[model samples]
Target: MHLLIITREWPGYVLGGISHHICNLYNEVVDKGHEITVITGTCPQSSHELTGKKPPANEVHTVQFGYRKGYYVLFPIALRNYLQSFDFDPFDACITHTGVPFELPLPTVSKRHDCYEATKEYIRNGLSFLETIGDRLMGPFRTIVDRRSIAAADCLIYNSAVCRAGWESAYNITTPSIVSHNGIDTSVFYPDSGYNKEDYILFVGGSERKGLSHVISFARQTKEDVIIVGPDEVNSPHVDALGRLSSDELRQVYTNAAVTIHPAGWEAFGNVILESVACGTPVVATKNCGAVEVLPSSACVVTSEIERGVMKAKNLNSEDCIKAASKQTWDKPAQDMIDIVRSITNPEC
Candidate 1:
């Protein structure tokens, strides 16, 4: 099968949730003996992101997109204009970042990683007063785009059930959809001796939306070390900040920590939850996190009581966490996607 995948946020450039999903999914699909053509936008590399890989030669097409911050609103228009002159007849199907303004003849799957509703929670995290007001004023426009993106696709693939449900509640969407949660880069993250049965607690989050308040509560109560990853700084004496780590570095952190706490209140799906457990560290997340759907109480606990939850989860059998994570590898989602596409393209298979 030949697949045409389009995204403005590609991995190895912009490091985020969607990029990891695309990179891992694309690799797994390629290994399954399928051809892929990727279309992407710009995300300049930094010193720490580890360059040397780009979109595959001849298979990738790039458009000089100008508004990086406004990509969500502007990218669809850019893609629509670009696709007007291009021929997509050769590809069997296409998967887009979220949605295209115009529909394609081939089977179209929009990767609804999250909905606009998710952005509203940023106000609680760190959005400035102006930004919050702007978000409020832009509600109508955002709704239009959201509805179009879903309507334009033949199907929508949500990264989590929470995300899917959010979209349903926000838009009352009748679009055909399926939940396909994300997977981790198993090459860099797996059960290892990185922890060596250590006693430090780990918290990975970039902003307050990732349960920063809850992390502070955990840090204040626990006498153990609290290692923080992603935030620029945390003034607490109990916290040690490791701002922005590479995948390998992060895997070590996940491994070394006695438990990784990700009490994200606004999360659709917590990839860190999967990554932590995959590295033999149990996680403490909330019921709001969609990834908890696959994890057991021994591997993850869904509660707001950070201290007790960590106590319940920290010493869970490593094998159980590993077993749960093993089932959600890139290969699993890739195969699920292929099956979805086949079901759509070949109804009688």
Candidate 2:
């Protein structure tokens, strides 16, 4: 099957978990005997992609311009010239990650990675008057595109059930939504990997919705050595800001962590939890994410039940956690996705 995958960010242009998903899913899906064409922005190398890998697969296409700060900056006009060079034929189907505007022929499937509705809580909880104004100016355009993106898709796939439900509530659109949980590469992240396990608790947040402030507050109160990895670093004594980690470095962080902390109030699917578990590490996550359904009985300790949860996580065996984490591989989810595309593109096939 020929698949065209669209993402806002790609491996070298990492912005969030969606970047990892797009990279891994495309690689795995293409490896599994399907032809894939990836469309993403071109940016500086992220800490995620390892140093000298082969060039991208034959079908991948990188669009060079992207939004930065509060504006869209076009790359060299030649990049646009390059973008115009390619002609897209009707594909078997196209699967797009949330937040990119890519048109496709035949059955189109959009994967919602996070719930913008939950992110709205961040804006409403308290944004400065200036931030509010800027957001309000941008609101109309975002809403129009978001609605069209979902509605235009032949099918909508969400990383978590919470995300799907949120879309339903927001748009009143009852599209077909499958709970396609995010996955981790167990080969890269496992207990035996050489990671320097530190004494501090770990927190990985890609966006504002991960509740970084809450994690900082908890760390400050407990005075625990806290390592926070993300793009934006909130200044706090309790936090050791790693800023951003490359893909390999991130796996090491997961391998060496004492306990992974996720204070996200509302998340679609928490990939950090899965990555941590793949490293034979336990996680302290909120009960809200869709991935919580995939947690081992012992590896997850809910934030609402902090004390008892911490105790349970400490007691969870590394071997058991690894065993449980092994179930959701890139292949299985990609296969599930392929099946969805087949059903939609050719019901009679």
List the pairs of residues colliding in candidate 1: 195-256
lDDT values, one for every candidate? 0.78, 0.70
Tens digits of per-residue lDDT for model 2, 153-268: 87888777777877777777766768778787877777754555666688898455677777777777774677888855667767888878776788788777788888777878
Model 1, C-alpha of 247: deviation from truth (Å): 1.7
How does candidate 2 fare on TM-score? 0.83
- The candidate maximizing lDDT is 1
Best by TM-score: 1
Tens-digit lDDT track of model 1 for 1-349: 9998888766555635666677678878888888888777663431213234333423777764666545666677777778888888889998888556667878888888766686577543486788777767777776777877788887788888988888888787777888988887767788665358689889998677688877987888888788899987887877988999888788888888888988877678888999999998899888878899878887888888888888888769888988888877788779878988887888799
Please report how far candidate 1 places residue 92 from its true position, in Å. 0.9
Q: Could you give me the TM-score of model 1 versus the true structure?
A: 0.93
